[model samples]
Target chain A: MTYQSRYAWSVLFRLFHWAFALSIVTLVVTGLYVNSPWTNTVLEGSRSFPMATMRYLHFLAGFIFASAVAVRLYLWLFGNRQEKFWDSAPITPRNIRNLFSTMAYYTYLTDRHETRLGHNALAGTVYLATIVLTLIQLVSGFYMLYPESVFWQKWGVALFETQQQARFIHHLLMWYFIIFAFFHLYIVIWNDIKSPEGLISSIFCGRKFHRSSS
Target chain B: MTRHLDKSHFEPKLSRRGFIKGCTIAAAALGLSDEMVPRLVEAAASAQKPPVLWLHFQECTGCTEALLRASHPDVGRLILDMISLDYHETVMAPSGNQAEKSFKDTLEKYSGKFICVVEGAVPTKDGGIYCKIGGRTALEIIREAAPKAAAVIAIGTCASYGGVQAASPNPTGAKGAGDVLGMPVVNIPGCPPNPIAFLGTLLHFLTFKRLPELDQIGRPLFAYGRKNHDQCERRAHFDEGRFVEQFGDSNHMKGYCLYKVGCKGPETFANCPAVRFNDVDVWPVSAGHGCVGCTEPNFWDTHSPFYERLPGVKIPGTGGIVHDVDSAGKKILGIAAAAAGIHAAVGIGKRIVKGRGKSDEDV
Candidate 1:
């Protein structure tokens, strides 16, 4: 057997991927703490803002997560053909067929997944949905920051009707990310082992291994 | 009928100083400049007081009690001098047929000119038979009067968003006045709303001849403009992360933030912190109890399990099965993890068996 190492991900794509993942992790950790503070650092006559600190970190990471999402969306529109959204995401009829085939492969109805360098159609669609969820989380978060501000009041607070409603939506989505992270890790690791492509390393090194001949 | 002697009987006996002081407080509450005090005084002294027909439905009269309890500038004098209380069910001197006649006369006299203040939830279920006053359902009464009034004010949470009566399993199908009337009504939503908030709204209407600026929920922005957390006296404690762990702990004595013990201040938008109830510098948070978030719409349902950080989500179609969000989230994640583990084990096992068979063929 012979294999070829091909450049699969753009440098910017890799950067956005890592930034998004890191920030999402940071956000979930800090957000959970903010939702229900587990630590009570009440020293005698002492003052510390663990909740405030967690919130500040959460907000800071939220901005980074939003910006990373923006970069990914921009790359989807204008990037190397492989990095473009359509390369993996099933938008057209042919791609939709590929998506079902990929699902069949995952469900063990088929022994083979279609050969693709980037995300399989199902993964791509899930990522697209994730971007949408991230946007909702951002809107909900930003609205709560300045509930009194005219801009947010009109767009965020009023739209949600109450700050708690927005908070609930935001909190609900946090669990989604947690569940997503679990499935995401398991599947990606499975791919790294089972698939011919250097799946996991491709994210870090921007290269994938493909069988040249066997 | 003997001709009523002493026209002064109709006039409120307010001392000029107290009247001026009251005007100042009103101006402040209305977010008007100090210069607006004289204008407020002038508005109050003007002979043409707006006729207010206050209606009570499924309520405890707490809003009225709070209003009457205002001591500074004497809210009793303010209410009497500023607006002609045409037909408050609780405070009216007349009763039975006389009271009914007064309400009828006010409706006739002040058609399209009066302020209709509704103080409780209106029931619409079963032909609106849940709450009745003088043989008319609250729904019937509000519908008859609200459209005719210049403006409608839904005082207290009950009138604003159906309060406790409209909470889940709302057997009577209680709804707010605005919902019942199907028109915009100014909502002053608190369990027992601060008199200052109501006074501000009243004074704004009297002085400017228009309702004050209202938020999306139809609450006066001057009062419901900021969240209770923002103006909280113990805000420093919140920022500093000092919270009351329990009701009687030392932290409580230190006046720490009540966020930990389920203070809904962070979500509640009310001026309770800034304008304490009863003309004293004391609100629920100030008195060492966390805010119950009485002002926000649907507070009874949304802000309940009130002593907790978050409301328990009632699982739909589960026949009243309620679980805390955090616990439910953890359980969901745990289930996902276990499923993922099982899937991985199956996938890995299949791969090992397939690989062994393929390697034996190569050997």
Candidate 2:
């Protein structure tokens, strides 16, 4: 029953986590609004660009989201061993075994919970997928924003061939993020409830209390 | 029944002043600098007019009809007489073997000199038997004529990207001239392209002795450079989110954006808004209809449901699992929400059964 506090998330990681989360939430809201603005209510007696303003805000949030993701990527490449990119690699035989075990635990096929200081194999794999999807979103968003720019016109046209296809992909991928966010929140909350060793607080306070094996 | 062109008889019909005016207008339309006007005039006035061989395939001859209906006085006349116009099946006063003889004679007489203006999609299925002229399939005629010409111009959507004939389940296996010729073809693609586009392209070549700059699809950049949405008069409505939800609604009458009603202007690349069709200040958008993205490749098949914003994505191998993007997205969100709700209910039930009382640590 003995418990020990261990440093987990870094200060920078915590900041990035919030920034990324906030930006993504903002982007989803504004992006959906841009796709189909819900209001025809023009400001009475005043000439204002509501849709344009929404678009600008959306674009700005997109840049912030992209930058946060970039910073996380940099940390994954150059940070401590515990935070290294390989920590999220789901391909190794050991990681694969852990992934299945984690899947089994979540599905209630197994009662044993394998305790880990970092993200479990299944979570790490999902994060990897998120990173890839974020990259696609960034590229597609920027390309659509400045399709006629010289470099993008040449390379982007070669890549996407048309703006409609790029738009379709961008819109479709937003749903993926939405679905992922739901599952992510549920898992995090469920895990914290199951093991009350500062599971949720670790992200905020950079430390987690784990039950000592002894 | 072949009719000989009496250049002397036709020369007097177009005044030097009218011809020069047409050239200037054409030069401007072609996106050439004002300085290019003199060159255009010279090109037009030159004794040796550029020969043109007009070819028709699987088409409705709408493009020719549009050209004939040019609003500017003498524009139609200039288009017809300014070029040698060696052969045009629609306008030519010849038929049967005489027409065939005229086409052959013109092709040989102006080899490596004439411009090949193809006006329709070339059918390739069943050896292009769907469309034939003078015992030759469109494929055979294009193959023979395109390579020998100094330049090739695909005058309408059909000639550019197979148009309506190439729509889904295209039985005729119709294709554009560029696909058939296996060479770059200057494409001026509209359902029935603005005749001015064709005129400008022709004038540009005649004036400069080379084709104008083109976009990825071989469409003259001047005409297809900016998107239709960019120059649309109703763009302010789009920006303000004042859209026509349906045809003939109050907003539509107020000239609101047609986006919600399936205007493809955003995706369509053309100068339709800038240079209104038939020289009138009205385009499809102005006339209260959404652009069908007629200038784009595969418009008929890809840009369908002209009243919808986004086209449905057809699932492969499925008989018909075409999903509208907006609805599909909403469904996914609904499913995710439901799943989260179910999982939360299950978790709460488990917690209640286990007697693990809710603690402040749950936050």
Candidate 3:
């Protein structure tokens, strides 16, 4: 494809991007207030409105995030066939080797190798792990939240009498994201400095300077 | 009728007015006021001291300590004076073999008539060798005495559920009176049970001539009827999630609930919050440490590491954590995508603003 017409993110993925970010921010702020680390007064002094609003907002944001993730999952499953979304994160040997090599290359261990059109190998595996972790967190979180509903209560809390069990799992999930964020920042900065190109703007403006295949 | 009533100028030492005034003051202090005055007066006049045999075993004399510190002077004295105490190991001037002889004699004299009040645990290990009085194990002595008594009152945690002695790896096999004696044992359990519970049960029995209704654990339903969390004054703090994180912190001093710091009050059944202790007006939680759940069964074993919370028992759509933000679980997707997109986009924004190559590393 010509440089001007190079493929980037589809409209759905771009929309999903902004929506997920907004929802995440909302959830974090609201979640902290709900089980406040500072003071339980987040909902205090409100005759009743703020607490009820936070509860509603928390659930609503979760719904939006869940829907976006679902759509993204579908896109991963059935995009284009050959070099489609499936092949982007393939478990092939070359990709696996590249994943390790990319990690090594970032640490200045060796010279860089040829790049793939889609996600690098290490990126693909992390993607799978993140997806799996998010799915578990979502299910367990929802299960714990309303464990008493005809749904969660009748058959949920019995699985774990102590809320501590779920808390441990949930806390562990947070560290994963933070670690991922650190590595992600490192790689992007390193790549942008080396290339000096507009590779970063592809998601926003739907355009990029595509390098020719050897 | 012979005029014998008119002949004697001598009256007994006590005057009627002084005694009545003393009782009225006592009844008021017990929080039972004028409306309840007639009942108290009638009860005091009609009732005799309930015959009691206070037994001691593996104990610290704490229940006795709590009872002695009773706020109402009359109630404190009433338990001692009104009742013919037949035998009490601690307060009775008699000791050793002489005391032993008195206990046996009283058991015979008041068999099936006196209330058997047990104050401590009975070590059943190796036939109760852990604790002894008068050269006989508390177990052997109690087993012989229990069946003949009219009613058995297990007065403290030690006698109620073996107290601290029955904590994990209980080497002596300390057992409560209920388990050791086949008789009906009414448990007034606490590390040292509130004195009012003991007095209330005793007085109720004297009036009714029957044991009060007890829960499965032999605790009187009237006193240990509800979980401490249900009636605790700081309970709203618990439900609101405003917790005191440390000792002497502002929240602790402000009277916040101790549930966050491992107060087992929510799960424990007792009225300690209402009845209080030693009439000091503040208990352990008020002192900033959480409730150790001294009254509940297996309290020592089940509720340990006293500062950490009991795994929060989520009630589903009720009191529960709202999200997966413990570490970073909740924002997984956004982070993954945003890191990818933001850093990429930040690269572009830098290039447009700074005109490319002269700019800083995207790193």
Candidate 4:
């Protein structure tokens, strides 16, 4: 079979993308509880399940998220230099201007697509924000998750020792993530629906179907 | 055998001794031993019939329904007969003008003597057009009745905080009696509020000639002090973070904590978990559902989705387990703060080194 390959993403990029997406879905499912809503609940046999399980799920998901971040960083350092990190995603004045342009272009509020590799400026900025926020969640989450981890316990206590304080930070971030997620999903759907190519499957199965003739 | 044969009708009513014997039997049935029966006996013998004036306003009359179904029959009947039930619209046989006339008569005869129990909120918006009785506003009824009352009690969430009707976009601008009447209305706030809580409040008022210690909201601290979270049996699950993901799911079947799905118990302060519903130890959460925080302020608004916890409150140093919204917001905001600090440190460190380089060049 004759094949054509105009590179959209590297193999490593696709792997990181899929795994990160999966972990985020898992986190969202489990995150519903991170703050909890009920009290004085009495279940006949709910003892078999416990909070530890949810935390374990959250932490396990975090590890995968962190691994995804690690792979992205490694790709930045070791992947093809021709794929310059700063070219498409940097926050320089040029990209900052492009961020608004990309948003406008996507919304059909404008029609301008800049030459890009990987994420556009707006996408890059949001992705960076996600990474940073995820890292914060991990740091605070782990500190609360494994208070006995001597390293985390010490730092957690130094920063926020009381259980109440840790809880406050954990809960507050959950809402922020929810709001971020709603908009993030909107952008994804916007791209997937508006664009001739289905954007979601591209991330999931490693192939974007395009209307443009190859 | 009859202590009060002074009247022929009093003969069949059974004397105090026989009544005490009946009380002993009833108390024994309640898990209280014969020894503890004396407390109830003493209470009954006290012959304290606290005069109660049940006033209705803009409401569904659910509080009255709850009162009829009160668990303690002795308390209920005693409150009815032993204490002069000066006026109650639903239970009182008199109706229309006569029923309202009874209220006026009581106000005149028992001026500064009766206990006024107000149900439902007073609609103060637009000249109190929301609720009208006898061509007068509920706001007017409460104002006229409250001052002369030995103790003013606002029963149910409506009378407490205007309840579901007073929720956002409140067309009538309904407010709790305390807010509308400009007085400290002892609020017994629940959806309908546990009837026993009303009885208990009345008991304290009658026994002490004053109100029980109140929370900041003027609710009885006896009923509103501890959070449903603190008293929750599933709290251990919350501490461990076990949550029910869905209804009728395996986790729910096993009785896992409902905190994850938005139980508001952790942030809502009430005795639902301890005292429970219908004089049974089963409450909303204990029934395998999450707390809706019906007893809290703006529960319909502040606490909603029935399964989600409210925002965290602030604490000193903000320990990991705080449940207040203000505190949690501050904590999350700390994320940006940490990032800013890291950036500042990096910049400062770079500037210091650059200064050293300049100084060395000068040297």
lDDT of 4 by residue, B127-197 (tens): 98878988888878888989998888999888888887788678898888888767787999887677656
Candidate 4, residues A1-214, lDDT tens digits: the string is: 1223235556788888778778877776676545443333345345544455665787799789779878877776676532345645655788888888887665444433554434678877776777777666666777655533557645654555332345456666666665566556656765554343546665655455433323
Q: Where does model 4 sit among the CAPRI classes?
A: incorrect
- Candidate 2 wrongly placed segments (more than 4 Å): A1-4, A42-45, A197-199, A210-214, B1-12, B106-109, B313-318, B321-323, B344-363
The best candidate by lDDT is 1
Better-scoring candidate (DockQ), 2 or 4: 2
Listed per prediction, chain B TM-scores read 0.93, 0.88, 0.75, 0.75
TM-score: which candidate is best?
1
Ranked candidates (lDDT, high to low): 1, 2, 4, 3
Q: Can you write out model 1's per-residue Cα lDDT over B1-363, one digit (the tens) per residue? A: 122233433545777876788778878887788988888888888999899999999999999888875645366577767799989988889999999999999999989999999999998899999888888888888889999999999999999999989998899999999888888999999989988888888888888989999987789999999999999998877766777888999888988888889999999899988878665578999899999889988777777778887777779998889998878989999999898788778776776877744421122
Superior by DockQ: candidate 1 or candidate 4: 1
- Mark the regions of model 1 whose C-alpha exceeds 4 Å error after superposition: A44-47, A157-159, A211-214, B1-12, B356-363
Q: Interface RMSD (Å), each candidate?
A: 3.8, 4.5, 9.4, 15.7
Best by DockQ: 1
lDDT of 1 at B339: 85
Q: Which is the winner by lDDT between candidate 3 and candidate 4? A: 4
Better of 2 and 4 by TM-score: 2
Q: Where's the lowest-lDDT run of ten residues in candidate 2 chain A? A: A41-50
**What DockQ do you compute for every candidate structure?**
0.46, 0.38, 0.09, 0.07
Candidate with the larger TM-score of 1 and 3: 1
